[model samples]
Target: MDWDREARTGLPEAVFCAGKTPAQIDAILAEARAAGRRVLLTRLDPARRDALAAKEGLDYDAASATAILGGPAPARPGRIAIVTGGLADLPAATEALRTLAFCGFAGELVADVGVAGLWRLLERIDAIREVDVVIAVAGMEGAIFSVLAGLVTAPIIALPVSFGSGVSAGGRLALDAALGSCAPGLVAVNIDNGFGAAQAAIRMLSPRGGTAQNAGPS
Candidate 1:
């Protein structure tokens, strides 16, 4: 664990569980409990989640592939929005949602609103605009980020997911398009990094003026 991460950086420590063994994850969880620290474990598999569920104080969300130790912070209205291009994008969207939940922020989801059917997204324009920040999750061309940027004044956090298919090449094109977007108030995070997107939104909505100097909520 990064002891100074919360105080110095204003972010909690999280475990990446994709490559770690069950025993290793358990050890980390034990450490977190021992230190009275809240931790999030990302990319966790269902088997591991189930196995660890027996442990005291561990909650797991299968859709997001995330597990929480020491309970999530209480959720409050934070005026955050999460929109996805298609159903295939829900996995990524779920990750952001779980992260937001852990940080005590509430968010709404606008699903299956890809640019191909612009009308779907157009229908939700007014609702999306009411939020302080928008998280656009897409995988194919990642055009949603730029499109949303042109419409909403709220800052957009572009989150790209990997399709693992031809040409798309695990979301490289989407990532590239998001980074090169011409629209204002659009920021891009790493491909499939839903947690990163959530953290960015939390910072943007932070009353502390979006600087690490102001520590986040406990």
Candidate 2:
């Protein structure tokens, strides 16, 4: 089924189900199970996940719209810090947490830290700095990336969540803010790409199966 992606990339292929039909998703799941491989499906609807989970060895997290086959990885070192700008960003933040759990890393969630009330973030700065890498999830201009970069020495992985309408809507502005930030240690993933962000952190933290304590920023 051409699932050799894991062999080449050192990461498993994830099934993105936004446009795929149920039968297609089922076929892919079957193939992965047959090969004894672990798989992740993103953008899956709740009803579909509930229906599939009934008979398959799948566990679903509706908040993240993600489903996992095969058990999670064994626990490892290097914690991940997931910071969300607002409540609207929880879904994506949860996605990063679930992905980090699957990847065998512990993750901490710092919620509702939008720029509008910078105090929320400042209060949690000490906790956030304790992690190996930070996944900053935000919408509406994504100032969290630059702010965190300025304060912490950890590597910041920006995840821009898309919502709202018109020009600054759908996370374009947020994505731009992260990419265009003058901060020294900021990195970025696509809009709502929590899974990708998690993978990046995992690789950075566990390069060659070793802790990244001295691997430099993130």
Candidate 3:
């Protein structure tokens, strides 16, 4: 994949930390960072982050369940907001945010703002309106994206997280919700596919899908 498109678009490469062994995740991260790129690791285990302590310029977020590569956030020409439901959704949400930051967009996030508390989302209306695009990182019903699409002018990238238990077939509900979104602006990504969502968002924001030199995953 053209990971560098994110760089051209001013976004970062993302790591999927689920299912894979810690060593695999770490190695993948090494490749990305070695190319002078920052990364966002999602669904990473606590132990995994601990093992990576030897690495400098790393920021770990237990709440967000993410690890951002070293260095300051990248600057963006347009605004992209990432909204998540509960604290549990933060890990995936942060992954999206880091992707945007790595890709070159100054991204923003609104955490714990699911439909249960519409007011919380309403309060951020100003911030939502200011952004050019939005990435909704959620599990469960994934209604957050629909709500955002209804309320904001910006396009929304809906991510169905695979965090729910029960007969509730792994993010299927979230995916269905996104697919059923009546709002014209809602776009859905794969289940727990923050990398895909971020790449798509950045491509739309970037000029002409960015240059080939900036293509491919870093």
Candidate 4:
């Protein structure tokens, strides 16, 4: 763990828990505790979360597969809007929201506003326009990315979710769509990388200074 990441990059180092074993996670948590640090764990599946539940101060969210060891950072100044193409994209959106929360930034989830139902997204356009940054989550062809980017003035971060079958099975189609989008200034992250999207928003929110502090464990 790079303990001084928050001081150097304006964000703390987060543990990616995809391939880590239970004992390894335990050791990391133990080290963090000894150092009196606040840590965020991403990609923490349910089984791992259950195994580590005994650790005090462990806050887990199964939907997004995320955990916070100490606690969320204090609220900071920034408004983020997370828009999802459909109900199936909620998991990815939730991850972005959780990341924002852990980083001390607040985000509003605008769910199920895909281009399939143009009226639904149009209805919420005003609210989505009020934020400093926008994260658009979608699977399938990912037309929502371009649509939202064209509609919103804030920078758009397209998060392609792996939530479809057939040709769109693993989100490659969505990823390609996001990459090929003609919308100017639209950027994209990997498939289902909500954490990355949130980090981009954080960078945009704090371009000059880092809002996060390396505080002791709560």
Candidate 5:
């Protein structure tokens, strides 16, 4: 596959591995790298990482149940801040940051500051305000988006993950929470889609955001 669309439009191709075999993963990786584009793989099982470590790079953060590929770290300008509900949400946030890096865009990761404690989010307002975009990863009520929308002027990317348990209504509670938000500028990608969120942010930050015309955002 021609993977240059990512670099061409400032959006990277994401390989979601929540349900793929090692062979499939390897094939995708080979194709992506062959096209001279960065390859970002997320949510791999522990054993899978070990199986592919020799051929593919890995940043194993066992606590987060995440396997990261920080390849090509997109050479982007401007800061993109990543905020998670708490330490529990690090895996997803790290995934977001990793995806950003793959597109050559480095970003800041802020965790353990859920809106439950308003003061925590308040303290980071100054720093959060400076980011060109904000990726809010939350679960179990996921009210973080509403609070963040009120706090920052930058475009907010609300990501609802399967962080909540059964009674927690899976991630729907979080999804509903974000959608219910009255924030005009706030937009959502998909469930636990940190890679997608990061990709969109870069597009907006690139070449004055959407003004690049049919030539593909110069």
Candidate 6:
């Protein structure tokens, strides 16, 4: 479980629940409890979440398929803005938001602002610009990532969502676009990896002194 990870890297170990059986998850949770640790669980589907419903202090969000054990830590010092290209991208954006919350950071969601309707994003530009970091979630051509990067001074973390048809299927098109973006200094994580994007933002916002308080939940 890498119990010292928060002390070593300013980031605690998180459990990825996908492909894990109920018994295995129970064991992991039991171990965490025994160690007096707080843990975040990602990719926990509704069925699996239901299976673990008896777990004490389990805070589950079905939309993002994420769960928190031992509750979230106190809020940290950082402002994050999660922008989605469209309503279809909300799941990925929600994951990022949940990750930030679990890590004791506050973030806001700016939804349905795809370039297809540029006015939507333009109207909300002011609010988004106020954040320390921006997470852009999009599918299809993923023009939103580049557009937001160009518009905002904050670091842009492109999170490609798997929501589209044809060439955009499986989020590959959006992933390629993010990787190939002409926007200077724009960074990208794996397709649909909202948790990774949140962690990256946390690292960017973490105190330079490497204090354990800034490290995510213990």
Query: How high is the CA lDDT of each candidate model?
Result: 0.85, 0.83, 0.74, 0.91, 0.73, 0.90
Off by over 4 Å in 1: 50-54, 209-218
lDDT of 1: 0.85
lDDT (10s digit) by residue, model 3, range 2-97: 465444554444666767776776677777667876567767778777776345666776755666776545465787888888777766676677
Q: Order candidates by TM-score, high to low.
A: 4, 6, 1, 2, 5, 3
Candidate 1 residue lDDT tens string, 109-214:
9999999999999999999999989999999889999999999889899999996468777999899989999997689999999999998888777655432455
Runs off by more than 4 Å, candidate 6 = 212-218
Off by over 4 Å in 5: 31-37, 53-70, 208-218
**Ranking 2 against 3 by lDDT, winner:** 2
- lDDT for predicted candidate 5 compared with the true structure: 0.73
lDDT of 2 by residue, 144-203 (tens): 889999999888999999964676599999999998999986999999999999989978
RMSDs, each prediction? 3.0, 5.0, 3.9, 3.3, 3.5, 2.8
- True-structure lDDT of candidate 6: 0.90
| Cα shift from native, residue 165, model 3 (Å) | 4.9
Clashes of each: 0, 0, 20, 0, 7, 0
Which of the predicted structures, 3 or 6, would earn the higher lDDT when compared with the native? 6
Evaluated against the true structure, the overall lDDT of model 4 is 0.91
Candidate 5 lDDT trough over 10 residues, lowest sum? 209-218
Which 10-residue window of candidate 2 scores lowest in summed lDDT?
A: 209-218
Candidate 4 clash pair list: none
